[model samples]
Target: MDVGLLFDLRNPAQWHRPWADHYARTLELCEEADQRGAGGLWFTEHHLFEDGYLPQPLTFAAAVAARTRRARIGTSVVLPALHNPVDLAEQAALVDLVSGGRLELGLGAGYRLPEYQLFGADFQRRFAGTERNIREILRLWEEKAVTPLPIQDPPPVWGGFYGPRGARIAGRLGIGLLHISHAMFGHYREGLAEGGHDPRSARVSDLLPIILAEDPEAAWHRVAPHLAHQVNSYRQGSVEGTGRSTPLLTAEDLRDPNAQDTRGLLDILTPEDAAVRIRELTKDLPVRHLIFWASIAGMPDDLVTENIRLVTEKLPPLLR
Candidate 1:
């Protein structure tokens, strides 16, 4: 399995620190991770979130490309429904050129209603729009000629799918597939079968919340608030056609707040509990690439580095 790191660029606490410091630390992490043999560094895109979520992932990717020589740079997802397809294609092509063809584009139909409203896009037809945009982007990158042409062949494309229809579309288009953490092994396998393709032939990846720490209590204390943020955001509301939005996960929502829970779960795991959860999650799944979204609300930079070190050092041995 190819191990990758995912950054959401969230500014959880209004900690009194220079923005440049954060960016510098992130670059430090990227360089260190590359030296440690990480396969890639993935970024996320979000708009109008006061939480310091990145609004321009391509720009960030360009910066990353300039700083790091070996690690692949990618967006965990760019919301296709919110972008003009041609412009996005041009930007993506430019980033690919800048990175010497090391670009993995992850496209999504979008899910947050507020984001759609902010973009003035109709939430109902987002999937259709996303599909159309993907087709247009492919054409623009592969067929259409531009003023400054791309340096290499078109960048590899990965379509993020939450349901069967999107998966089928990806299969038809011969694009890579990105599955979520929940029950995606079964869904991805079934989708490949339905598309009349061997599961082994499909290029697939998955993203999940992961942390590796020696002390369970310390890790949970650092990560729980951020976890709560994600769960709350999804539960507040979810767009239709987005598969299985997170249920309400407030502190009150926990049946046993003190209990360390892992029953009936597929991908999520506590750091000290289930070391083999990663293997189990990917066992029957056709995931050659695995990206871990690695941040908890108030996790310190040192702890984050340690978490990355543990995954990079410990997980690869297990896989071998």
Candidate 2:
């Protein structure tokens, strides 16, 4: 179980300080995590969310690569539906070279309707566009003399899948798989098998919210509102396009639930009681890596460091 860190570039009220301070602290956290023997850093991409989220993952990843010495840098999921494949390929390749080949590219279809509208992209064709863009990106990386030649070897790419079709595509393409939270867990293994991929040979990773504290009660107070807001954001976003109501969950829902709510399923552990639940939720899964989104709701740098130390120092030895 390799461990990694996830940064959402949250624009929370608590972090209303200057952007430079947040950026500097983020770099420090990455370096600290690297020194503590963490595996990687995963950054997310979003647009038009005044909530202080980043819209450009490749640019952010490039900065991370320049600052960190050993930890691999990755995009949790870049929306290929909204990007030009050629430019993405070039930028990703340049970052790969800068990092000495330590890049993990996770590509995904655009999901948020606002982002689609803002970018002037047709939301309906997102899946198809994502598939085509990924194919072109692979071609640009694997083939030589692609009009504008890249600077280094092709970086390893991963398909970010939230459904069965995307999972199948990942296996067929022979790229890695990134499962966000727990939405696809039940069908992921079968999807890989259906695509004629051996489960053991598949490189599957997941990103989840995490926090570690000496006092569970105190941690809950700090992280609960943020976790609730995150869940609400997904639910609100899902309702506009899908015409479905997002279901809420109780504590009992985590253990056993009759309804299959995607948000409920994915928010597997609420921050109010995450430490113990996270340990249990990860067991028995083919988790190649566990990436912690520690900057949720703009947590303080010290808290982020404590969470990373908890995973890298305290958790792994027990798992072994």
Residue 38 C-alpha lDDT in model 1? 76
Task: Write down the TM-score of every candidate.
Answer: 0.83, 0.82
For candidate 1, lDDT tens digit of each residue in 1-320?
Answer: 57788877777554424667777777778778878877788887777655667778888888887777777777879988898888888888888788787788888886777788788898889888887888788887677655354665667777788687777666656677887444544555565676676766677786765666777566665566566665554445454235555455654343254635522222234443444776676665556678876555445776688778766666666666
| Candidate 1 least-lDDT 10 residues | 262-271
lDDT over C-alpha atoms for residue 259 of model 2? 51
Q: After best superposition, candidate 1 residue 254: deviation in angstroms? A: 5.2
Q: State, as a TM-score between 0 and 1, how close model 1 is to the true structure.
A: 0.83
Which candidate achieves the best lDDT against the true structure?
A: 2
* Model 2: worst 10 consecutive residues (lDDT sum): 262-271
Model 1 spans with C-alpha error above 4 angstroms: 14-16, 147-152, 180-200, 237-275
